[model samples]
Target: ASHAEGTPGQAVAKAASAATPLAAAGGANHGARAMPGNALPPYPEAAREDGLEGLVRLAVEVDAQGRVSAVRWDARSGVMLLDIAARDAVRLWRFEPARQDGQAVASTVRVALQFRLDAPVGWVAQADTR
Candidate 1:
Protein backbone atom coordinates (compact mmCIF):
# COMPACT_ATOMS: atom_id res chain seq x y z
CA ALA A 1 0.00 0.00 0.00
CA SER A 2 2.81 2.41 1.00
CA HIS A 3 6.56 1.93 1.33
CA ALA A 4 9.03 4.07 3.20
CA GLU A 5 12.67 3.35 3.70
CA GLY A 6 13.58 3.07 7.38
CA THR A 7 9.91 2.78 8.10
CA PRO A 8 7.33 0.02 8.11
CA GLY A 9 4.93 -1.08 5.31
CA GLN A 10 6.07 -1.64 1.73
CA ALA A 11 5.00 -0.31 -1.66
CA VAL A 12 2.29 -2.26 -3.44
CA ALA A 13 0.31 -2.21 -6.70
CA LYS A 14 -2.86 -3.55 -8.31
CA ALA A 15 -4.01 -4.23 -11.81
CA ALA A 16 -5.81 -1.30 -13.42
CA SER A 17 -7.27 -3.08 -16.39
CA ALA A 18 -9.65 -5.98 -16.35
CA ALA A 19 -9.03 -6.65 -20.02
CA THR A 20 -5.29 -6.89 -19.56
CA PRO A 21 -4.87 -10.63 -19.24
CA LEU A 22 -1.12 -10.31 -19.59
CA ALA A 23 -0.90 -7.90 -16.69
CA ALA A 24 -3.41 -9.84 -14.66
CA ALA A 25 -1.34 -12.98 -15.18
CA GLY A 26 1.62 -11.38 -13.38
CA GLY A 27 3.39 -10.51 -16.60
CA ALA A 28 3.93 -6.95 -15.51
CA ASN A 29 7.27 -5.73 -14.25
CA HIS A 30 7.42 -2.51 -12.28
CA GLY A 31 10.87 -1.14 -13.03
CA ALA A 32 14.09 -1.59 -14.91
CA ARG A 33 16.34 -1.76 -11.90
CA ALA A 34 19.58 -3.68 -12.16
CA MET A 35 19.47 -4.22 -8.45
CA PRO A 36 16.12 -4.64 -6.68
CA GLY A 37 13.96 -1.55 -6.29
CA ASN A 38 12.51 1.09 -8.52
CA ALA A 39 14.41 4.30 -9.10
CA LEU A 40 13.62 6.85 -6.47
CA PRO A 41 12.97 10.35 -7.61
CA PRO A 42 14.87 13.22 -6.08
CA TYR A 43 12.87 15.00 -3.41
CA PRO A 44 11.13 18.05 -4.73
CA GLU A 45 12.26 21.16 -2.95
CA ALA A 46 8.70 22.27 -2.34
CA ALA A 47 7.68 18.96 -0.83
CA ARG A 48 10.74 18.80 1.36
CA GLU A 49 10.21 22.34 2.51
CA ASP A 50 6.57 21.62 3.24
CA GLY A 51 7.27 18.26 4.83
CA LEU A 52 4.73 16.45 2.71
CA GLU A 53 4.38 12.69 2.49
CA GLY A 54 1.84 10.35 0.88
CA LEU A 55 1.15 7.96 -1.97
CA VAL A 56 0.66 8.63 -5.67
CA ARG A 57 -0.88 6.05 -7.97
CA LEU A 58 -0.03 6.05 -11.63
CA ALA A 59 -1.15 4.22 -14.74
CA VAL A 60 1.92 3.65 -16.84
CA GLU A 61 2.07 2.34 -20.37
CA VAL A 62 5.24 0.58 -21.39
CA ASP A 63 5.96 0.09 -25.05
CA ALA A 64 7.40 -3.00 -26.62
CA GLN A 65 10.81 -1.39 -26.42
CA GLY A 66 10.57 -1.56 -22.64
CA ARG A 67 10.29 2.19 -22.35
CA VAL A 68 7.62 4.26 -20.72
CA SER A 69 5.36 5.57 -23.45
CA ALA A 70 2.72 7.34 -21.38
CA VAL A 71 1.79 8.04 -17.79
CA ARG A 72 -1.45 9.14 -16.23
CA TRP A 73 -2.23 10.29 -12.74
CA ASP A 74 -4.56 7.71 -11.26
CA ALA A 75 -4.25 9.04 -7.76
CA ARG A 76 -2.51 12.01 -6.20
CA SER A 77 -0.81 12.72 -2.92
CA GLY A 78 -2.94 15.88 -2.51
CA VAL A 79 0.20 17.92 -2.91
CA MET A 80 0.84 19.29 -6.34
CA LEU A 81 4.57 19.14 -5.96
CA LEU A 82 4.44 15.51 -4.96
CA ASP A 83 2.20 14.63 -7.87
CA ILE A 84 4.37 16.45 -10.35
CA ALA A 85 7.49 14.88 -8.97
CA ALA A 86 6.04 11.42 -9.37
CA ARG A 87 4.96 12.11 -12.94
CA ASP A 88 8.34 13.49 -13.99
CA ALA A 89 10.27 10.63 -12.52
CA VAL A 90 7.94 7.91 -13.78
CA ARG A 91 8.09 9.22 -17.33
CA LEU A 92 11.77 8.45 -17.40
CA TRP A 93 11.41 4.98 -15.96
CA ARG A 94 12.09 1.90 -18.07
CA PHE A 95 10.42 -1.49 -17.84
CA GLU A 96 10.93 -5.09 -18.92
CA PRO A 97 8.36 -4.94 -21.68
CA ALA A 98 5.25 -7.07 -21.33
CA ARG A 99 4.95 -10.03 -23.63
CA GLN A 100 1.98 -12.06 -24.85
CA ASP A 101 2.27 -15.41 -26.53
CA GLY A 102 6.02 -14.93 -26.65
CA GLN A 103 5.71 -11.56 -28.36
CA ALA A 104 6.56 -8.26 -26.83
CA VAL A 105 3.57 -5.94 -26.65
CA ALA A 106 2.65 -2.65 -25.10
CA SER A 107 0.81 -2.97 -21.84
CA THR A 108 -0.67 -0.73 -19.18
CA VAL A 109 -0.28 -1.28 -15.50
CA ARG A 110 -0.96 0.54 -12.27
CA VAL A 111 1.60 1.33 -9.59
CA ALA A 112 1.45 2.93 -6.21
CA LEU A 113 4.38 5.07 -5.13
CA GLN A 114 4.85 6.35 -1.63
CA PHE A 115 6.86 9.38 -0.68
CA ARG A 116 7.88 9.91 2.89
CA LEU A 117 10.24 12.32 4.61
CA ASP A 118 9.88 11.07 8.16
CA ALA A 119 13.01 8.97 8.17
CA PRO A 120 16.15 9.97 9.97
CA VAL A 121 19.00 11.78 8.26
CA GLY A 122 20.79 9.88 5.46
CA TRP A 123 17.84 7.54 5.24
CA VAL A 124 15.70 8.86 2.43
CA ALA A 125 12.48 7.14 1.43
CA GLN A 126 12.13 6.44 -2.24
CA ALA A 127 9.03 6.40 -4.43
CA ASP A 128 8.03 3.34 -6.50
CA THR A 129 5.50 3.65 -9.36
CA ARG A 130 4.88 1.12 -12.14
Candidate 2:
Protein backbone atom coordinates (compact mmCIF):
# COMPACT_ATOMS: atom_id res chain seq x y z
CA ALA A 1 0.00 0.00 0.00
CA SER A 2 1.12 3.53 -0.66
CA HIS A 3 2.33 5.29 2.47
CA ALA A 4 0.25 8.33 1.56
CA GLU A 5 -3.02 6.46 1.43
CA GLY A 6 -4.75 4.44 4.15
CA THR A 7 -7.23 4.61 6.99
CA PRO A 8 -5.64 6.21 10.05
CA GLY A 9 -4.69 2.97 11.82
CA GLN A 10 -4.01 0.97 8.68
CA ALA A 11 -1.14 3.23 7.70
CA VAL A 12 0.57 2.67 11.00
CA ALA A 13 0.13 -1.07 11.00
CA LYS A 14 1.42 -1.50 7.47
CA ALA A 15 4.36 0.81 7.97
CA ALA A 16 5.28 -0.88 11.22
CA SER A 17 5.36 -4.34 9.73
CA ALA A 18 7.45 -3.10 6.81
CA ALA A 19 9.94 -1.24 9.00
CA THR A 20 13.58 -2.10 8.63
CA PRO A 21 15.22 -3.94 11.51
CA LEU A 22 18.19 -2.26 13.13
CA ALA A 23 18.48 -4.63 16.04
CA ALA A 24 21.20 -7.25 16.24
CA ALA A 25 21.08 -10.20 13.86
CA GLY A 26 19.78 -12.73 16.33
CA GLY A 27 16.32 -12.08 17.68
CA ALA A 28 15.97 -11.63 21.41
CA ASN A 29 13.95 -14.20 23.33
CA HIS A 30 11.75 -11.31 24.42
CA GLY A 31 12.05 -8.03 22.59
CA ALA A 32 11.89 -4.73 24.37
CA ARG A 33 8.29 -3.63 24.68
CA ALA A 34 6.76 -0.21 25.23
CA MET A 35 5.34 0.38 28.65
CA PRO A 36 1.71 1.28 29.03
CA GLY A 37 0.80 4.96 29.50
CA ASN A 38 3.73 6.34 27.58
CA ALA A 39 2.71 9.63 26.04
CA LEU A 40 2.02 9.85 22.34
CA PRO A 41 4.04 12.26 20.26
CA PRO A 42 2.19 15.43 19.55
CA TYR A 43 1.47 16.11 15.92
CA PRO A 44 3.32 19.17 14.67
CA GLU A 45 1.14 22.16 13.97
CA ALA A 46 2.81 22.94 10.69
CA ALA A 47 2.34 19.45 9.38
CA ARG A 48 -1.23 19.38 10.54
CA GLU A 49 -2.04 22.66 8.89
CA ASP A 50 -0.54 21.43 5.67
CA GLY A 51 -2.30 18.05 5.89
CA LEU A 52 0.92 16.11 5.90
CA GLU A 53 0.77 12.51 7.03
CA GLY A 54 3.21 9.59 7.08
CA LEU A 55 4.86 7.03 9.29
CA VAL A 56 8.19 7.49 11.08
CA ARG A 57 10.10 4.43 12.14
CA LEU A 58 12.73 4.71 14.83
CA ALA A 59 15.39 2.45 16.24
CA VAL A 60 14.95 2.82 19.99
CA GLU A 61 17.65 1.54 22.30
CA VAL A 62 16.37 0.46 25.67
CA ASP A 63 18.72 -0.14 28.56
CA ALA A 64 18.49 -2.98 31.05
CA GLN A 65 16.82 -0.68 33.53
CA GLY A 66 14.01 0.07 31.03
CA ARG A 67 15.04 3.61 30.22
CA VAL A 68 15.48 4.86 26.69
CA SER A 69 19.17 5.28 26.00
CA ALA A 70 19.12 6.49 22.41
CA VAL A 71 16.97 6.79 19.29
CA ARG A 72 17.95 6.83 15.65
CA TRP A 73 15.83 7.17 12.54
CA ASP A 74 15.30 3.78 11.00
CA ALA A 75 12.95 5.29 8.43
CA ARG A 76 11.75 8.81 7.79
CA SER A 77 8.14 9.89 7.49
CA GLY A 78 9.12 12.18 4.55
CA VAL A 79 8.19 15.14 6.66
CA MET A 80 10.89 16.70 8.80
CA LEU A 81 8.54 18.12 11.38
CA LEU A 82 6.83 14.80 12.01
CA ASP A 83 10.16 13.02 12.16
CA ILE A 84 11.54 15.36 14.80
CA ALA A 85 8.38 15.23 16.83
CA ALA A 86 8.38 11.44 16.85
CA ARG A 87 12.04 11.24 17.83
CA ASP A 88 11.72 13.80 20.60
CA ALA A 89 8.73 12.06 22.16
CA VAL A 90 10.23 8.60 21.96
CA ARG A 91 13.35 9.76 23.78
CA LEU A 92 11.29 9.98 26.93
CA TRP A 93 9.64 6.56 26.62
CA ARG A 94 10.39 3.72 29.00
CA PHE A 95 10.32 0.09 28.00
CA GLU A 96 10.26 -3.36 29.53
CA PRO A 97 13.70 -4.41 28.47
CA ALA A 98 14.31 -7.44 26.30
CA ARG A 99 15.03 -10.64 28.18
CA GLN A 100 17.55 -13.35 27.46
CA ASP A 101 17.74 -16.43 29.61
CA GLY A 102 15.24 -14.73 31.91
CA GLN A 103 17.46 -11.73 32.57
CA ALA A 104 16.79 -8.21 31.33
CA VAL A 105 19.17 -6.94 28.70
CA ALA A 106 19.73 -3.85 26.61
CA SER A 107 18.48 -4.03 23.03
CA THR A 108 17.17 -2.00 20.14
CA VAL A 109 13.60 -2.22 18.87
CA ARG A 110 11.86 -0.70 15.89
CA VAL A 111 9.10 1.82 16.61
CA ALA A 112 6.66 3.00 13.96
CA LEU A 113 4.90 6.28 14.70
CA GLN A 114 2.23 7.54 12.33
CA PHE A 115 1.06 11.11 11.83
CA ARG A 116 -2.37 11.41 10.27
CA LEU A 117 -4.74 14.33 10.17
CA ASP A 118 -7.75 12.03 10.31
CA ALA A 119 -6.63 10.35 13.53
CA PRO A 120 -7.93 11.58 16.82
CA VAL A 121 -5.64 13.90 18.68
CA GLY A 122 -3.03 12.00 20.72
CA TRP A 123 -3.87 8.67 19.11
CA VAL A 124 -1.91 7.97 15.97
CA ALA A 125 1.12 5.92 16.90
CA GLN A 126 2.13 2.35 17.63
CA ALA A 127 5.34 0.55 18.63
CA ASP A 128 6.45 -2.87 17.53
CA THR A 129 9.29 -5.30 18.20
CA ARG A 130 11.85 -6.20 15.53
Task: Please tell me which predicted candidate would have the highest TM-score against the true structure.
Answer: 2
lDDT of candidate 1 over 95-124, digit per residue (tens): 666655556667665655666675411212
lDDT agreement with native, every candidate: 0.56, 0.66
Error of 2 at 54 (Å): 1.1
Against the true structure, what is each candidate's TM-score?
0.64, 0.72
Across 9-76, the per-residue lDDT of candidate 2 in tens digits comes to: 22223222221232233355566767765666666877888889888888888888889998999899
Clash number for model 1?
A: 0
lDDT of 2 at 103: 78
lDDT value, candidate 2, whole model: 0.66
| Candidate 2: regions farther than 4 A off | 1-28, 121-130
